[model samples]
Target chain A: MSTFIQTLHLAWQNTNSLLCVGLDPEPTKFPGALANRSDAIFDFCRKIVDATAPFACAFKPQIAYFAAHRAEDQLEQLIAHIHLKHPALPVILDAKRGDIGSTAEQYAREAFERYRADAVTVNPYMGFDSLEPYLEHKDKGVIVLCRTSNPGGSDLQFLDVGGRPLYQTVAQRAAEKWNTNGQLGLVVGATFPKEIELVRSLVGDMPLLIPGIGAQGGDVEATVRAGRTAAGTGMLINSSRAIIYAGNGDDYADAAALAAQKTRDGINAYR
Target chain B: MSTFIQTLHLAWQNTNSLLCVGLDPEPTKFPGALANRSDAIFDFCRKIVDATAPFACAFKPQIAYFAAHRAEDQLEQLIAHIHLKHPALPVILDAKRGDIGSTAEQYAREAFERYRADAVTVNPYMGFDSLEPYLEHKDKGVIVLCRTSNPGGSDLQFLDVGGRPLYQTVAQRAAEKWNTNGQLGLVVGATFPKEIELVRSLVGDMPLLIPGIGAQGGDVEATVRAGRTAAGTGMLINSSRAIIYAGNGDDYADAAALAAQKTRDGINAYR
Candidate 1:
């Protein structure tokens, strides 16, 4: 009967880990032994999930990677596998979906109903009503894109709005107006430590899903220092490419586990 | 071979219709005769497409209505059907996708490689890099969301960036920098005539996809007047529910054709 946030926090405490491993398996990067397999992406991700489950707080699977290969049903199976095997571990579907009303409802169903993701990432471009349908599902988490972890993050996000950056405005609104259901979280890139600190102050206890840590060249110490709340429990630092492809050998799963353990310890060192 | 814009202009000239029919078929709202059939959505949209082909410059299929039923294969079939029957008419998949870098490439593949949509709508919240991958495919159209047609369009879109609204800034940037591939368009809601006029002036010759007519209460005259360029060929006025559900009986396809023709003529009167 625990809420989504409560469940996430419980698992966070249980694992004592803030690391959320991203399950992105590029077929070309798969181990040579798995190249001939029909369901290579699924098999690759399942191994990553199994290897990193004990050391991770959450799992995130980017939908585009699966949908690109017409493997959406495999994504469904992956989510089901995680829930059945590691019920405490939440799966955040990295689908930055945004649309108006009924269209938003279908995206909601795609994330929560079809894949049963405990949380889903969403884009906030179309404003409140685009996300209002997802917010209605109180038991699920809706992580709104605030300041993305990309090279072009400054293009539109830095636009001045009322003497504050646009990301701050979005964070303020998510804290004050959009979290009536308490199922809201904000995404702030780990590369922008100062912005992450500012959002941390504005959003109080609402969790921030921090990307851009490993392959994206975000400093782990700065991320952990700036992103944590007063209670030291508000950030889910994600590392995908670095952990998943830590070693492209037969012991890839073991290498991923080692990388996850190192990342977990690294975050805890700063915390 | 014509470019995406050139193909769109060719179709616009051939039909003399700026009208884009949205093939969004909801099962519960389907005409009773076809509701019991398993492939009802594809069947419904095929008939609508067949009936309205003569009056439409483009066909838009909303992804939500298709994904809601786990009938993505049906959507694929519908797109294939449109390509086979009416190769001249472009199919714009109304999947408002936005993500960052590598993930964005996968989404681009989902729209272009998987679904074979000539154009795909994208949200611009993640800034330039999120839409950059889609822009890489020179032959495909990347329609960014601007001033949307929803009730909450003003929530974040109206924020003052410098002296102008945020949507204006977005339009300015998209016009100046984001059209590098020559396959760029903007989505401006028909409900806001003044905004449409402002965006048209800002973006110059870039086409605008105008949603929010008919069921959304947008006036056809104002949309045609404000959304057109000097050449009177820069607008694609879309009507979904009002035209598609014009009847609930066996004659629904004929009724849809009539509604589409009326809408087309109404837009032409102002053009």
Candidate 2:
């Protein structure tokens, strides 16, 4: 196993949970302590990291929230702060980037070399060539979008490809073909429990980052049951908005930690 | 006509050229004059905008380059500078962002509302609903990825969808169903001149953003000939690295302007 997998396994063992607290700090939903401050996003993320570092196996930072703001330095500070607060907890940058060959290589450098993210979310629309650069980082994880947890995700993902849904083909290819470096993972949305079950079956032992849990209204019990691997080890249940914005007052961090614990307990209930 | 279309038409009349310079400034490719400096990107873009503003009909900034750095401020500055320098020049934010409803709405706000781009590129993988938010801005152009200009683009794009290649189906859908607001355009790679011809036939009057021109080794002459609408008003030939990095020295801007002129002349040769 690669360093990322080892780190992930170690995290699970240490936390006694498979929960990944998604650090998607939306500006409007920031706590009162940080509401009108210039460093609101950074402060909120720092507190969340400090509060939930013991419970979360990993932290997934959605790139869109940071990208939406003009204060990019704050994003870098947030990542740096996370690393300082929880040195061992893996930071997955949920950017969902995809592009052609050389351009993709530059993006890989930006994400891994510049930001030092342990892993990243990628869109596979441009095919395997776009993913080759990320795969070169033997220690980093490349999570490809499989069956997303959204209403329109079925539009193209469910399109017939050789008498099977395109997502199934993506899953099989990711498991057999794309995981050559042993650093592959799939972003399976928890909203579609049946699809999650199908993908879990298709991709035997690969790690799965299952999002869409809380805010998206995914059935936690059904998703956890459907997403577990045969070894019962390769799953990361992500809860973003629901946990981050659990409270809008000064006790937001405590509320976030409690919300994260509840999600972890919910997943454990299914397990 | 929409604001984007009107801007392009006016730009064509003013410059007497149909060239659209693609501003994709990779940090690694920055000259020694601006080595490892973030501010260099803004300076590079401003110079290019000033040098080629009078020669080109529009400017296409590939969002991936700016997004790679997650430099939202730089992108905003770049767009603002372009509008300030060349007030009537349409800025197409080449960001192939496509997601489910709410997420798509956020992306639309980022590209159109926050950045205030005249046009934006989008992926059609998630289908109509993902693109609806973009199309709602009827005065701004929404360029859908139809037939990309990359080698592996055919892997999924050419897949048989209901007994037809997916690109053809995408073209048909864009032309018939998705073009309700008349704010649609297609991204047809310049490398595939034949596919360009086919897509042009499908999307009769809609504008086409043709990339893969200079550095990607696309045949500019054939692309312009096969991709242009019958009225000769539908193609936006984009050449990124070749024009921007035409010379690696202090004379880069002048060389880029000359390179833009050459690309424009090359496209006009076939026209």
Compute the lDDT of residue B271 as modeled in candidate 2: 76
Report RMSD for candidate 2.
2.1
TM-score of each: 0.98, 0.94
DockQ of each: 0.84, 0.53
Taking all chains together, the TM-score of candidate 1 against the true structure is 0.98
Estimate, for each residue in A1-271, the C-alpha lDDT of model 1 and write its tens digit.
Answer: 2278998889878889999999876888998999998888888999999999989999999988898888888899999999999999999999888899878998898888999999999888888898989988879999999988898888888889989899999999999998888899999999899999999989998999999999999999999999887767788899999999998998999999999999999999998
Instruction: For candidate 1, give the docking quality class from DockQ.
Output: high
Q: What is the lDDT, from 0 to 100, of the residue A35 in candidate 2?
A: 71
Q: Rate the local accuracy (lDDT) of all candidates.
A: 0.91, 0.82
* lDDT over C-alpha atoms for residue A247 of model 2: 84
What proportion of the true contacts does each candidate reproduce? 0.85, 0.36
Q: Write the per-residue lDDT of candidate 1 for residues B1-271, one digit (tens) a residue.
A: 2277999999988899999999778888887889789999999999999999999999999998887788889999999999999999999999999888898898999999999999999988888888889988889998999999998888889999998899999999899988887889999999899999999989998999999999999988988889888888889899999999998899999999999999999999999
Pick the lDDT winner: 1
